[model samples]
Target: MKWPWTLQPFIFYPQGGGQNGDQGWLRAGAEEWTVTGTRLDKASGVVWHAVAGELPPVDTQLSGEVDAHSRLRQMARHTGEHLLAQAFARINPAFEVAAVGMRGPDCTLDLRGSPSEADAQVAEALLREVMVAGPLTLETQLVPHTELGRYPLRRATPLTGDVQLVIFRDTAGELFDVSACAGTHLPLGNLAAPVTVLGLEHIRAGLTRVTFRAGPEAAEYLGEVYRSARALAQGFNTGVAELPERVEALRSERDRLAAEQSRLRAALAAALVTAAPVEAYGPVQLRVLSLPDAGLLPAALSEVPAGEVRAAVAGERCSVGSGVPELDAGALLRAALTVSGGKGGGRAELAQGQTQQPEQFLAEVRRAVAEKASWSYVCHSRR
Candidate 1:
């Protein structure tokens, strides 16, 4: 569960205001416990450190060490969100900061009103300009609740007692932002290098969520993207800048080849149908044929005269069509597949299916047609 640290002089920051808590270790003598997360009990005003392993004695004088890397990452993301929110506000007055999320690797800023692609681009440009303007000065101040109106706040403060305001100013003492916040932020300097927006999506009807990354995290992402692009370009034997053009060219060639292939298949189907010989079985005239491509089955069957029954096989695929009402093509094909070990079905006039045993499938169709059409036994035996 959690260990309460309410004694005095706390070093760990608890999870609050949408930012994650400090993660580290607490040790007293040789006994140590790992703190996975920290949270505040708002009702009791107690900060609880969630830990693993055994808990130390209540009075043990344990010292804690916060994980510096994680803290810095959290700080960078939180600061970047603040600056980006202000940038959006400057772009349009309607784009108010509705909410902020800093729990995960990527932070999100939710704006009150939806913004177009152009508006988002302008906001990102403004943020880039602020990031390169040298180290900014951050000032945290405690002011009476009623005196909050003195400073220009980006939003109304929720705190009822003394309000904590984080103020940002450029080198020339020009104020950039003043907002009431409880989250941990970078004490000073740039809001990490290479802060950029990832993308945007509509969270609701009027709200838009902007995903972004900053500092070391952003650098790592950009590095991976560059490596992936280089690998793809090398596979295509082209430079990274020319990869898109090469891909478009390949797609065009594929379409042209597909159209030519369709034309060739139609010609082959017509030739196969014309070459097959028809055999007379009592009142039924039957024609059997084999095709090279399964896709040509429909075209071949369509060429058969209305006076004849046709059965054709292409690889594992087979089709049977009955022109005479005495033979049911659907029932005939179903019986054949039962012995051939594959599956398909169609109407009585036309039926198509796949079977592993092509010879056995065709023989089954021939035998069934002979029996259903009342062909002379001597004639069936001769065929």
Candidate 2:
């Protein structure tokens, strides 16, 4: 039998402007060969199929097989992009489809102008309509430059030579977009599922980029997004729709609690001063009290009278004095209180210190301050 390579007529080229070419295997008779790669020759505009395994003679015929899965993805994405672009033209007549490019997972169209939210919604609605319209017919024809002015066709410049144009027509006899595209497409419009516009970006002053997904790929992307949202809602113990509200409520409660803490600290400081007492420190009068806790120290210091009262607490002592400016009262108190291995210091007249035994601390500080005053008195009396 003559070589049956011509029986399989499907040929894929790697040089598709909108998408990359397909890759797979080829079989002829009992021999199987692997198709390593494919590339489009710019010189001849024909696809060069690279294969591995045994090579047939130069004129030998072989069956060509393209990867179906890859082909379907490209078709869905490319066609979906066209539908989206048509919608853009409908919403804004000034918007022009600048360029269309395709990759494995998705396709992109550069628009001459940015679109608003309303424009995007209209585009999405039109895509839905195309998906429901069923199979689409693809026709490629070479028309004279003068004839191109009749349809909504995009042209860069009149071709001096033969010009190739690809047109897409839906089942309703409605034309979606007519452009000079050299990409593969589905036979029927319904082959591509309803497309979802993933995102839009303003690339430059007048250019916008739109990305979209179609068919099973669209379904899978949406499924992943919903799953993540559900997991987050469960972790926060709120309905998915109420997450924003719940977050705001928690923030408000935290602020309220912080204010309450500040008020409590102020009240405790005031109460400490009300509990101090007056006593004699040798010749001068001093107010000495062992504070119930360190929390009361601020309030106790605030209550001491200006000069007459020299106050010190043994267990958690902080003192402020109004009289006896020359005495290093704070230092004296810290030193006397240090017998308990506690540390404290303040200014000459106002000092604070802490000790383990509150009673012993008060007694030591009082005796130390008195003794020091006595030494000063004796020295002054002789002079």
Candidate 3:
């Protein structure tokens, strides 16, 4: 589109898919108009904007205004994509740009190749050079299809008639890429600010999707991430740089405590076996051990002899651990289940169960263990 002032021409084809539409005002002398949307009119071979409010009369000196923030971000993402594409080209000459679209605060360039870390690094370096140089120049030209073969054009389909191309050049007049493009672009290297690569992904076997934010969007995204990390550090009373170490320390502490609890349970299991009273269904081991903070039943079970000891522990709730094989422990656990109605299962050699009635589970365990000795019996009360 033509601008009244000495401004570079803009092709309204947007850049990225994830980025949003551009919004800005249009000014013609005293009257100011708002441009709500922009689209390519294929029939007319021109970009048309959906203008709001009254527009200036035809041939009036009018200037198209773009959202500075949005434009800056678009440039950053677009340039970043160029850098990434250039890097991929260096790695594999066969790799080429499939398509490009700029949206919102980001831009996406679909590339055809499996990019490597070296390629990414090269792209980053190229992007850094653009940012350092600044103020890009974009020139558009129409060349005949016959002339396309002379330039290093990356296109799958053959061109017919005349084709529109965008040429990106830096302050030193170094050419970046010359391709048929419809998106708006920054002058040469003048991107308002540098672009940063946020992330990259392999979208398909042969295609790569690079996600990047530029200018204010990049600053904003990074700022939020920093704030979260700082808050986490503050919560742990540590420096921001030390947050990772602090988290690792907390994890290590938890693991150590778990190991200690396991050891204590094993010792308690041995003690419960030695202090049981003998009864009819083998040694009726009834030991009301004060439950530790963890794994009370397994600890108690480990102490008792196999098939001879049936133990129960009372804590925040009640739990049963037995050493008897082929016994329907569920049947024995029914009384505990009736009071609290919790369920659990394990191998025949050792079964465990939980119930909310911590006080009543001890009496229930004693009764359930005494009644059954075979595998087929179901715990009628449990159901």
Candidate structures ordered by TM-score, highest first: 1, 3, 2
Listed per model in order, the count of residue pairs whose N, CA or C atoms clash below 3 Å is 0, 7, 21
Please list the C-alpha lDDT of all candidates, in the order they appear: 0.82, 0.67, 0.60
Tell me the lDDT of model 1 at 146. 90
Q: Which scores higher on lDDT, 2 or 3?
A: 2
Q: Write the per-residue lDDT of candidate 1 for residues 1-383, one digit (tens) a residue.
A: 66755534568889988899899989888888888888888897778888877777788888899999999999888888777778888888799988888888788988887987788889888877876776677889988889998998888876778888988887678777788987777877375656778889998999999988878898899899889999999999999999889989999999999888878887888777778887776667887888888898987776456667888899999998887665778888899999887898998788999988888988888777777666544556689
Candidate 2 residues lying further than 4 Å off, grouped into runs, are 1-10, 28-31, 50-60, 133-142, 154-164, 234-383
Of 1 and 3, the candidate ahead on lDDT is 1
- Top of the candidates by TM-score: 1
Model 3, C-alpha of 318: deviation from truth (Å): 7.2
**Per-residue accuracy of model 2 over 236-275 as CA lDDT, tens digit each:** 9878788778878989999999788667755865554445
**Model 1 backbone overlap count:** 0
Writing each residue's lDDT as its tens digit, candidate 3 over 112-221 gives: 77666557667767656765765457788888878887766545336588877777666677766666654455664445344556666788889877665655676777
Q: Output the lDDT of residue 33, model 3.
A: 74
RMSD of each: 5.9, 13.5, 7.5
Segments of candidate 3 deviating more than 4 angstroms: 1-19, 25-66, 91-122, 129-136, 154-161, 170-172, 190-193, 200-209, 223-280, 283-305, 308-323, 328-339, 342-367, 374-383
- Tell how far residue 263 is off in model 3, in angstroms: 5.5
